[model samples]
Target: MRKQILFLLALSLLCISFTFAQNNVQQRKIDSEFLNAVHYYENKDYDKALTGFDNVINNYPLNSKTTASYFFRIKILIGQKEFERAKDLTNYFIETYPSSRYIDEIRMLKVKLYVDDSEYFDALKEIAFLIDRTKSISYRIEAKTIGGQIAKSYLSSSDLLRLSNAFTGETVKPYLLLLLGKAFLKEGKKGDALNSFTRIIGSYPHSAEYFEAKSLIESPVSGEETSSGQALVGVLLPLKLNSAGEPTSNTAGEILDGIKYAVAKFNSGRTDKIGIVIRDTQNNEERIKQIRNEIGYNPNIKAIIGPIFSNEVRIAINDFDATGIPIISPTATDNDLTSESENFFQANPPLVIRGKIMAQYIFFVANKRLMAVLNSVDGYSPLLAATFVDEFSRLGGTIVTRQTYKSNSLSFAEQFANIAIADSVDGIYVPLAEKSDAPAILSQMVQDSMYVPLFGNQDWFFAKGFETSPELSNMLTFSSDFFIEFNSKDFQEFNNEFSNITGKDVNRNILYGYDTAKYLLTVMKNVDKNRTAIKTKMISGLTTRGYHNNISFDKHRMNRFLNIVRFKDGVFELIERFRSGSL
Candidate 1:
């Protein structure tokens, strides 16, 4: 009986060992499949990779590969743009594999996905969670980078409270300091911003932020080495002395009047001041070259303005390379010039800046849901349309349609009809240069039963035919830099002075010219006629209490304040004023 019992025990042991061996083989197979899935996923063949991972999960439910498989499957879902599904899978992975090494990476990816989908608040929540949960240095750096970007976006519109809240602790202190400086700069608080930047320079000397901080603070003010008395101001303009098919020279004449007025005012009380020199390019390339050659030899010419056409501006930039003379265009609205020339500045707001402001006004101020952009054939029109699209989309708004039309084309009924068929867009933005075209566009839209609100640039108010077109008058909203309706007495007094000097009514462009002169004079009073110093003053958001607006400059030297106007009963009225911080 003892021998029989020993044989049975031995057989049972052998059977148990065999079953264990089979289980090991199966687990190895699942592990191999899971690794293969990861390889395919890295190769971007997400469909097959997902299938393989699913097979691993189904075949080896309790194996070591299970957690890894869940993690990788979440990645594949994200790659496929299946965000909602990927979010659910990520939650599952976090719950089931709480000890997984990739938890922080998964959380970062979730933040990125939310950002990509325009779910900013949700992304902020994930960032908060990651900051609260993780001690990993890499993850903390990532959180700071993302948080800084979001804070900068809010700061663009002058939302400082949100920006301040974004950086809370010592871990993100450096980035917060830099961002606070930028925010203060946006709100026209130069002293504060400068202080913040100076702090970074002093405290974080070894960091990369210190390098950028130093570069910014040093570049703009360096040009002030030359004195105003020693420097010559170059004015490049198309004088339009003889041009066919042009209006009664009212616009150019008014511009020149404003320039002369500024110069006269500056020369009135000052002794040994900088002299203003004018160069008329006549909108010709050869003339521009001659003018550039003349200015190139004269060291007295420290700055320039005008060359109103976009092509002319390009020529001027190429001809004046490394001259260190800043060119401020009084009327040019082209966007490409600024990108090409660091020395270039636009006294009139660029189309892109105006477009961005218009988008913000419509989406945030007016609370409009859907926006449609109607673009003209003018070169600036496309840029305006594109900027509106980009800024609106960035702010979590949808663009209903982008319509393009040839200048002087009368029949827009078909285009209006098609736009009307699109889901009800609450606002429409038409950037047309010619007033004659405004009535036709508005008439077609109104005839098509499209009563949605319309928005446009200041040009709409100056358009000639808009006065008689009731439909256009009723549906129009526009933006301008200056308006006569400001309740401030200082503005009224300035308007009176401007009218007396120029003999023209006060408008946005006039205000721009006056402010431009005021700004130049202000710089002249404080700094020598050095282009660098003037640029620094311009970029530093120097405060100017002007007739049109409380003006300041951004990093790119674009004006930060815009007045929102609406046309009612045949006149443009200032409906609201928009500044950086006031939303």
Candidate 2:
């Protein structure tokens, strides 16, 4: 009986050894196939890469390399523009490996593929899933953004109505209604527009689009109230102009939409119509020069908003300086814009003032007495650092070290060594020209064991890798012209919509235009609509709270409402609402 039991144990042990050997051989095959696929992908031999990746994924589904194989296979399909096939595989991967490490990435790719294929309904379905359940805040936000574009631009009125009725996510309904209202307005369905806006104001009062919808309600009475006089405001932008005055992109249209929306809202219940005459400079300096006198001398044109490009503004301002018209560049950040033209009001403050303001905040608000400065030798960073050094020095602060380096040199060891921020350095002011370089900077700083507080410009807040490396953020404080409030996501939604339309960054240009127009037009009602009157009102400090920025132009004619923010616990927290100091 004991020999029989021993024989059974030996047989079981031999079976287990054979099973282990088979598993090892399977893992090795998967690893080898996956490696070859990676090599093929690196060499751009996508067909072979896809074949190898598919073999690993299908033949060894339980192997560790299988998930990676699926990822590579999907990537190759996407690169080959086989979005439908990529989406099918993505869905299969997600379903098969429900808890795979690559799940979220594959799902994100799935959403994009749906969007790319113009399968808006399916894309929205995927977006709805990710917005609530994804572990990625950025992915959640991007999902919301893409969803907004589908609602705002892609969806027809009937589709919007259908989706609004069918989609029961309370947070999403109001956004759809807001887009529906805009669509109605586009089609001249004013009553329908009113109804859509009213639904949001009544039902979704707490929604991110609440304030915007409330601001857009039509006049309470039947027609606009008969006001005293017509207030004409001229809009000078690169609105709907390609090379030959054709519509190249929607960025200019977005700016115009804000101004026009502000005008429409301003005229909603009021009898006095604020007329806007838009001159498309096409972002062309010569075009601005050509149209300068045409819009300049028009006696009815009271206030001028834009000619958005800084150089275009410089040219227009030079041409219109003698006209004494109030020219507000909603997006220009060039320091020379204000210096050259007294009539120019920059809603977005120039680089110099941004630096100076941050310096002021460190000295006055934070009470930091000593600081180190590190910036690139050229472009925005050095200019930012120079003004900061000037302002900090003028404000009775000591500069421990001012270090300059060549741009794009990932090796910051030498510069960090030179800063020597070991003692009495209250803060290190490192302004970066490219946000892409932030990871290298953060990594080098972490390696050097530099744990001092960092003061930087707005670019730092948007740095990609910083979210994953919050330890390197230390106690970062920065200045920005705009702040995106997740609590108020209507404009944030529009932000993404514009990005989709332009395929480029729109960085709150809509709000820049809206806030400037809203600020100026509000003043136009109080004072005479003449150029001098508008200019005086702006100079005397007319402050209006805006969506992305606060409008309170100080004596220097730059935006004084720069937001000071800090990185706390892996999130950006507003430290101060708006703060700026004198030159």
Candidate 3:
């Protein structure tokens, strides 16, 4: 009996030794496979990397290497923009590795997938889930930014009101005030806009959005009432210019819609039928010339609003300037546009001013000395980048590095990797216009555990992926000419009225149109019914405050006042105001 029991014990020990050896072999194989997969990923051969990662996941047990393999697969899938597959794999990872340290990362990727797919509502849900169920403060703050963005971009008046009511502390108070200020400005309630902006600036100076609030206070709104007058306001809008019979991408239909509303309001308030002669330029240069000729026939057309595109205005500026008809472009933002014609009044600030203001914010307000820049190769990025570098140096700040990337590149790994962000570096400036780029650079930074505050221009806020990625969303600080408090009583009123008029929500172009038209009506009504008189009035410090902006033409005829905003604890908090000629 003793011999038989000893034999059983010996057999059990042998079995346990064999199992432990087999497990060790499997782990070694997974480790080798994972390292090879990482090598493939490094070389940009996603297919082989994916295959190797898949092999590790399928052949190995739940260990660190296997856990890493799952995340690597997710990253590769996301890199491919195969978001649905990536999403499925992310879910599988969450379910399979519930206790993995990489879970927060996986959840963040899931949110990015949703944002990339334009599923903002779904992304919001995922963010809410992370905040509620997870202990990660970084993830929670990221959720706040996502919520603020959704509120900024898509929330209705009632929805914004509800959100405003729900989150009303210093943490979200600036955002709520901004939303309300925008809403008020949209509704033409300058007083309410002023109040909301004032509240943000006075109550929450340390809030990230305080800069924008201060700029809002400085937004020049001429409280001048419309006087009765007989003037022909020429409205040149590219209402439709596409080959498919749809409006072209560059058309100012929203601004045109706002002009219509302003015209209606003007006619209702006064006895004079201030004639609005509407012309569609098809956004074509030749058509713009034709429209100019048409305007020449109507000598009574004293003031013109629009010719929205800078290129379009370039085509017609000569004709209007030759005839002395002052053309106020509500959205033509080329820095040199005003230089082309003294008669041209730009409603939006030029990109050069935007760049200068951003540099000032970084150097003075944020108190950072050294910074790195990742600028896109095309669009307004290069120009903005040049302007910032020049201005930052002029302001006694140093650009540690400036890297450029093709706008169409799928990844900024090469860019971020090359940047040596030493302890002396204060912030990173990414002048990328697309939201896609924001996530690529930001995700790489997050994965590498590189925590640095980010600075940008307006494009960062409007980027598609910005609403989802918590790390990128939380670190952003930017500046722009437009900042609407979307939940203000004035905005609610404007939204209702505008929707009632056009059966649609108000857009930035629409607000530009409304403010421009209203300014034209107000200024023209009080001045002589002539182009010279209108130009003199506008150029001589004629200012009118809107929801969150001041619609004014400087002596150089460029728009004045831009809002500097920073993202912190989840909302783009106002930091300060950047006005023209102020370093």
Candidate 4:
């Protein structure tokens, strides 16, 4: 009797253990499926993700994976723009998991759905409810932010009036007035728009829409006597740096002269003209701030042109962006600046793009499969070299060796000594733009008789006496966006006119200023004369043919073209031009 009882107990325990292990394995499989669905959602494979999420939901009943699958399914549906399906899933999630922690998130997503569909009234109603009730800080902020956007959209006066009546939130009112002003302007009711803008400016001076309203009131579209019927643009330059900083007055003068010439040329050709307001930033942060504030209220300045140093640009971009004023930087090439603000547009292409341009030329045009890089430690040089390295390797080209020197280093011996001039190295890339370092590297190469074709960036041509160096003159090629051929008839004529006015030879700064001003003026003519419309239009993928290159903008607002130039008999000759969107 005892043995029989023991056997029965043993059999029951074994069955229980086996059942537990099997359940564990099944749970793990469901968890894995849920994770895979998440991965698919992240990778933007909406269809597969939906199938995977549905599988988890059906197979993992009342489990954590099932709850997560429900939330993400709704999110994916929303991403795919299946609004009705998302609405259904959301309702199902609320009914199925009444105690889920993601309720706020789901509600926020619903608010986004309404806003995206331009159901502004519905969005506002939901946002007002969220702001009043939700304790989740992030959720409340998201709801209020969307409320602001809804107020900014182009809406009928009736719709605007309805929104105002529905939601009297302090944060949402200013943006509504802003949109109202723009709508009034769109109807050619400048007086009504001005009245609306004035009310906002007077009542809500610290509101988010205040800067834009002030801008519109100050620089309206009508060619009225107050606005002088012209596009008033501002130019901020570091014309006079401190004594410690190099005095680049001549460069600033040339740039200014070019802008003046372009404006004069433009005005002479057309009845609609642009006027420029020049401000010297003095290369100081405080000065830039002061000037920006002054320009911010100046009623006459519609757009801004410069503040060339990266540091100064960083200071001014946010202010200009808030005011709906477009500021174009001609020479600041820091790639990080592109993300600083929307209104900050770079007229010079970034160094990384230049590096790719060099790589493409060496790979396809020069047919050099193996290359070596000589680099310098500077803000700009290493980026150029690394970009070239990445691109060259991607093109099936080999980087035989890379060497670097400290900035302002006089000797290239140590940097160059380790580079073995292999037979495979068909070219050498010199990624320094300075006058001394580039020529020093080239001279060392010449002494060793390693006559490889040397490649350089735009700064290589900026050196004054580079052409006089016999070792540096031949097999030397660099890239730039500005190259004026004296023999070209049109250039010759422009040169004469520019010389007559400025008594100075036109240089790179001049070319950039001319190009930037001309481009802005052309855009001004096409876009609405109001500040908001002009600002939006400038960022809307506008492109134009400039003097030496085609000026188009990338999504980040960086100039999109680079011209590869070769040095021959003291002149930099344009060998090839590369556009970012093209090969």
Flag regions of model 3 displaced more than 4 Å: 1-229, 241-251, 271-273, 285-287, 297-299, 407-422, 464-472, 568-578
Sliding window of 10 residues with minimal summed lDDT for model 3: 220-229
Which candidate's TM-score is highest? 4
**Distance from true location, Cα of 310 in model 2, Å:** 1.2
lDDT of each: 0.70, 0.76, 0.75, 0.74
Worst 10 residues of 1 by lDDT: 219-228
Higher-TM-score candidate of 2 and 3: 2
List the candidate 1 regions with Cα displacement exceeding 4 Å: 1-225, 228-232, 238-254, 267-272, 280-301, 375-382, 402-424, 433-437, 444-449, 462-472, 480-513, 543-552, 560-563, 576-583
Clashing pairs in 4: 223-229
Candidates ranked by lDDT = 2, 3, 4, 1
Q: Per-residue lDDT tens digits of candidate 1, residues 421-444?
A: 776798888877666787688667
Question: Against the true structure, what is each candidate's TM-score?
Answer: 0.51, 0.56, 0.54, 0.57
Q: Clashes in model 1: which pairs?
A: 157-580, 223-532, 228-529, 232-300
TM-score for candidate 3, please give it: 0.54
* Model 3 error, position 177 (Å): 62
Write model 2 residue lDDT over 112-194, tens digit each, in one string. Answer: 89878888877766766555456665565566656767765676677767766766666667766766786676667788989
* Model 4 Cα lDDT, one tens digit per residue, 211-251: 66876786664423233355688989878855675446877
TM-score for candidate 2: 0.56
lDDT of 4: 0.74
